[model samples]
Target: MSRISNGQLVIAFLACRLSSEMITIPGEMVSYGFDRFAVILFAKLIAALLYLPVIFITLKFKGDSVITAAFRRNRAFGITAGIIMSVLLSATAVQTVLSVQRYVTDTLLNNIVTISGIAVITASAVYGAVKGLSAVTRSSVFAAAVFGLLIFLIGVTMWDKVEPDYLYFSFINDRSHFLKTLISEISMNSEILIFAVITDELRSKPYKTVIYYLPILLILMEFLNMLYNLILGPYMTKVEYPLYIIASLSDIVLFQRLDGIDAIVWLMCGIIKAALLIYCIGRIYTVCSNKPHTTLAVAVSGFLIFMLCVILGSDAGVYERMTKIMNSGIHILLGGVVVPLVVLIAGRTKQRGRVKKNDENI
Candidate 1:
């Protein structure tokens, strides 16, 4: 496998973090009566704070992949983390696939035309994973370029229409709701797990990557939220894809409409995110089994996730239950908090043992 640059890795990371949520986040924020602009910016601040521990852990490992480093410290702990992360990422993949299907079917095509949207996305993700991280990383760069262009066009075309006064901040009276959204959104922004998973394949420095990439991601997220608030205001809650709706109103000279461009960006980013999730699962499978199972893992994982979407079968209750579980920071607690803490403890224990041995020898 070829080593990928930090820029490409960050692009892939941002693609996974930014795409699907672009549509739902605005609505989610509006429904909870949180200021759309402030909440997104707030979420990034919270995410950066929460991610400090992970950053410290990554620095400790230096050139090692976090997963491999954990295994060297304690195999059992590493395996546990892998299992937890695999499950968490798989659950996320299912939601992503569903979101992509919903958006494409709703905006670009009819039900009959997009009946196989789920299958196509799953297949594409599997193929990307099978091709390996290098391919996916390069593809993310292309996706990011497209995303950048789309963002530029939106900002330029919509500038005259933006309402600066609408960019308001307010403390929601519903404390519980506000806290939940805050925690969930922060956890949602923890796309660092992907970096940890593929640490070995990346050519960039971890500390620098985190420092440079996160602020940009946060700023882009803030801009999008501000755009939504400026154009749609409180009415954004009524729309399914407010950002896409805003894009549709763009009046660039060459492209009179930008919704299709917006959809393509979302679709491509969604697929990249799904592929990265599958790739992460495949990495864990390789670690646990002590063999490369990339092919088998991607196929089986994609199929299982697709089956899950099918089994749930448009049931609102089931979807809500799944969403609640995924969004409740359980993944963050288990994969981000618990597993890393355990690994850190194990590393300390092993280091102490080595130091004791040296003292006794002396």
Candidate 2:
């Protein structure tokens, strides 16, 4: 894969985050007032802080990833880094597949988004991974545009149904609930791990991407959270997909309803996210073997994700438990903080040795 523009990265990551948000599985708060509003806000702030090491190490190498840089310094170090990141990315892909499956099975109102959604999506993700990030990035632009339009239409239509009384804060009195939700939000920011791996390899460093992606995501989350609270009020907790429920009411003159549009856009985003994870995994394979058979990586990733979803069936509780175990705060800390710091130290140590050798020879 070739290097891509920062703008592409921004849209791709944004799409992935949007997709993750659209498919909130079990274990996430059902309703419980506006605590999620604060959760989204503070969780992202903390995720950004946690992800600083990764951002720093990636940019530090100029054109190479920290893993690649470290591998050049020591083969073992590089392979270890590759293995660690591969696990994290694989877990993320599996989690995404499970979430999509869960959302479909739980919300059976729409035949457009079918029970076979995971298989179709996995196939598309493999194809996209083979096509590479550039292709996925282009698709995300369209998905984002569709999603933005849907949000606009929903907001306009549901303005009358807004109830400000449901917008009360509750995280203050609920410390344990607040922390659990915060960790989940941070864990859901898998795009951070995606960004760290993909950008620096063959592309420009992601200085502008991070700046644009996070605030946009935070603002969008806040808007959607507020919209959920306003339109559904206390009743949102009863259903699985709040966006789908709200989209059912998006009845304007030109169109009938937008629930189908909503489902398609998020399904598109989920594919984009999965393809990205597969693509990044392939990139890591290149780093490990110095061979670039990304197609093999993509194929293996798609197959595994499909099988996992199939084996797990459509059990929301089981998928949620597995994902929670796989993508906890500890995993985030290891991927975003601990692993990057190790790669950085390896790269810097190698650089210092090179300098020392040059000086001694001189």
Candidate 3:
């Protein structure tokens, strides 16, 4: 398989990293009160700014995966970072399985095929991971296009339901709660940095050029959040999946219900997301073992994911608890603190090595 271009990298990052989860943002935002939209947006904007330095550092080690960069730069730090990331990614994959399963059962299959949902999702994810990044990239590119069309169609269909006035005037009533929720959103979205390790596979572009992609993604997410909040109103806070509710309300001449379409699109997006996480785990495992068989690494990682899905399938609550912990706890530690520290330490180490090399040459 050919290496992915920078364009593909962006698509993969956007599609695999971002999803209908943005639909839940409005629901989460409403909990802080409809007044919090501005606060959440501002908070997300700040978080995006903070991500800049990490992105720059990631690009500096573009050719190497994060695991490789860490180990080559600092063995101890790299191993520690790997363990932290592995736990988070594994937990995320399991959660993705549960989310997709529950969504499918509730929205599409009417709970009849609920138990089989996780199995189906796990199989699809494992297939993509085993096929390698090239396959994953191709799938993500296609999925991104389809996802865009779906979002556009939904926006048009729901145009009348949107209360621009409410969204425009909304403000967060509780400053502390708004700040806490904003931090959570940042932690969740910032996992895209995991892809930075493979940035070398992308086409080389100006540093600032990559930064431009951030706003586009953020805008799309913000729009989705706003739409959900407007349609569901305060009731959004009670809805587990606001996007599903929004999709259900969609009606056209031929289709009375669009929830199925949204569910399918989200299911595909979840597959891509899970595959990427599995790929990261595989790469980390390979790097740690110093193994040359990327194929074997992918298989082993895929097996683990499949096993986890099966184990978590019987108790949906367990999956939710695991995700709550990872999303709230591990994501904060890894994305908010551990990763930035690693980048700083790696940057300093690289500089020192360069100076030493220059002195030796002199």
Candidate 4:
């Protein structure tokens, strides 16, 4: 396998990690009011800054996968952290697959398909995971390009619907509600830490260079949040698939309808995201297990994920309930425990030099 650059890692992280799920930001902000978008943005910025020190410490430890680093420092603590993260990643894959299925059913399919969409999504994810990191990263680049084009096309078509005044109004009636909603938005994007665990061989770049990229990411997120609010407003809460709403609103001279195309784009993104999660879990299993055949571990992990999707049921109601449960649970585990524990253990072990070497073999 060839080395992956930090730049490529960053791009792959952004592509697979970021999604149109920000479409939900407007609805999430409804109780907080429009100004809450700014507040949420600021909170995310602070969260990112807080995360930077941990990332720096992880790098200092020679880029150990968070689990391995924790394990090296304390076996018992490491195993607990690993179990929590593995379950969280698995739950996220199921939730994301179900969400995509729900979006397709409500916007494009009209409930015509009888077979399970979860199965199809799981199969695609397994295929990607089997191909390994190179395949996953390449697919991310291609998917990101396709999504970018779709976003540009939709923007051009909906240029006339833009309203500057949408920024002036507040969405929340009370200050406490606004703060709570802002925290929720931060929690939603906390998945970034999952990527941090796998990223061991980043391109050599100055700290300042990496820090400079944050503004660009935050600006794009803010713009997308504002765009959805301006176009959908209160009506946005009623629609489960706000990106599809944006797609439906587009009408160019040659291509009058693009909701089908949008659905295809979403399906591809969903597959990439699911595959990455599986890959993360597979990596964790490989590190923790003493098994001779790592491929068997991967297969077993895939099978468990498949069962999870099936048990959850591939419907809108099931999807919503499962999301509420998984999101809340995972956020607490990640923010409340895993990150802090990893940092604390790594500090005590002084195992920074051995982490990179151990990670390379695993």
lDDT of each: 0.76, 0.78, 0.67, 0.64
In model 1, which runs have C-alpha deviations exceeding 4 angstroms?
Answer: 23-25, 31-34, 113-115, 168-174
Report the lDDT tens digits of candidate 2 across residue range 4-113. 78888888888898877876642356337677877888987887787677777767877566567767878988898888988888878887876765565555434644
| Per-residue lDDT of model 1, residues 1-362, tens digit only | 56788877778878887764653655564553335455667877766665555666676777666577787777787787788778777877887888787778888876633338888988999999899888997888888888889889988998898877765667677767667767667667546667667776768766666777778887877777667778887777788788789899999999998998888888988899889888888988887677865698778988898888776636768877776676776776666666666676777788899999999999
- Of the two candidates 2 and 3, the one with more favorable TM-score, higher being better, is 2
Candidate RMSDs in Å, in order, are 2.4, 2.6, 3.3, 5.4
List residue ranges in candidate 2 displaced over 4 A.
Answer: 25-27, 30-32, 108-116, 169-171, 201-203, 314-317, 355-362
Lowest summed-lDDT stretch of 10 residues in model 4? 201-210
Q: Report the C-alpha lDDT of model 3 over 1-362, residue by residue, as the tens digit.
A: 24666666667667754553733445554564455556546755765565555555555765455566777777777777677777767777777667677667766787556447766887788788888778987998888877776777787898888775555554556777676676656555634545544444455642433565566667766676677667876677778778778888888766677776777777788888888878778767766666753867777777777787778777768766765565454564565356756766777778899999999999
Could you give candidate 4's per-residue lDDT for residues 278-325 as a string of tens digits? Answer: 877777766566333255666677778878776676454776676666
How close is every model to the real structure, measured as TM-score?
0.91, 0.91, 0.84, 0.83
Candidate 4 overall Cα lDDT vs. reference?
Answer: 0.64
Give the Å shift of residue 102 in candidate 3. Answer: 1.9
lDDT of 4 at 111: 61
